[model samples]
Target: MRDNYREELDDIRGCLVDMANSVGSQLSKATTALLDADVTLADLVIAADDQLDATRESIEQRCFTLLARQAPVATELRTVITAMRIASDFERMGDLAEHVAKVARMRFPDSAVPQEVRPVFLEAGHVAESLVTKAGTVIAKQDVEAALELEEDDDAMDRLHRQLFREVLSEDWPHGVETAIDITLLGRYYERFADHAVSVARRVVYLVTGEHRINAAG
Candidate 1:
């Protein structure tokens, strides 16, 4: 029975990694759709979110069953708990990406985004996609060092988000108020997406070091 439990635990870890990859793909596509103003791609991102949602649910169910059956202790306990937490974070990341895709689909033909602000949005999208991809790597490899680097990359997205807002507000008379609002929300979505990826990376650091590096980072 112990052997069976051990196998199940490994399976759970694999499932979590799979879930992370799924979320990463969704985020990448969603951001791409938004940047390219590809409504069809945006629609695909929205549709694909359902699969991510299902994957997370399956992972959570297995985690729960393992806890109930094995009553895991020590490292096993830590593994199960971390898997649950990680899956939840990945699910939220998927939701945020879907939200960005929605923005693309809704604002197409005349994207609410101003021509001048396009560069900022593009930069934010690129950084956000990179962060999510790196996050998947850290989760799969348990590379605490790589996870630490992701925290710094997150700063670029934050800076771009702030600049976008500043530009929007500074304009004495903005064109297409609706488009401005959509772009503002879209920028914020990307910022928050990176923030969640950082959260996942922080969890990886803790899982590897048993120390919460989030607060320790100065």
Candidate 2:
């Protein structure tokens, strides 16, 4: 029974890693859909969100069951609890990707991103993807160092987000209010996606070290 419980815990950890990879893939496709104005691809990303939701539910149920049955303590308890929180972070990441896809669909055939700031969105996509990929590694290995590095990666996303605001708010900006709003929303989606990825990494760090890293605002 002890061996079986250990296997169950490992399985849950593996599921979290799989969920992280799925979120990364969704972001990649959403970025392509946004940049190219491909409604079909955008629709695919939007529709696939249901599967991510199901995965989150499955992870949560498994964690709850482990908690009720095995009564995990110390690091094992932290692992189970952190898995639930990380699952939630991954689900939110999926929603953010879906939001990006919806914007592409709304603007259909005309890229939501204008020519002047297309590069910013493109770079934001890259940073978001990189952060999630590293997050998966942190989950699988429980590497606190790699998890800490995600904080720096999140800073890159923050910089890109700020750059986007400057471009839209500049006096000489050409895009009108409607386009500016779309740009603002899209930048925020990417920025928040990176934030959640970092959040997942931080949870993993906590699971490994029992130390919580406070945000600047805290």
lDDT of each: 0.81, 0.91
What ranges in model 1 sit over 4 Å off?
Answer: 216-218
RMSD (CA, Å), candidate 2 to true, equals 1.3
Best-matching candidate per TM-score: 2
* Tens-digit lDDT track of model 2 for 166-200: 99999999879999999988988898899889888
Candidate 2 has an lDDT of 0.91
Q: State, as a TM-score between 0 and 1, how close model 1 is to the true structure.
A: 0.91
Model 1 residue 187 CA deviation in Å? 1.8
Candidate achieving the largest lDDT = 2
Candidate 1 per-residue lDDT, tens place, 1-218, comes to 99998888778777777777777788778767777788998999899988888888998899999999889888778888888888888888889889988988887865656777889877877787788778878877889989988978888887898888877777564675776688778887887788888888898788789999864321
Off by over 4 Å in 2: 214-218
As a whole number from 0 to 100, the lDDT of residue 168 in candidate 1 is 79
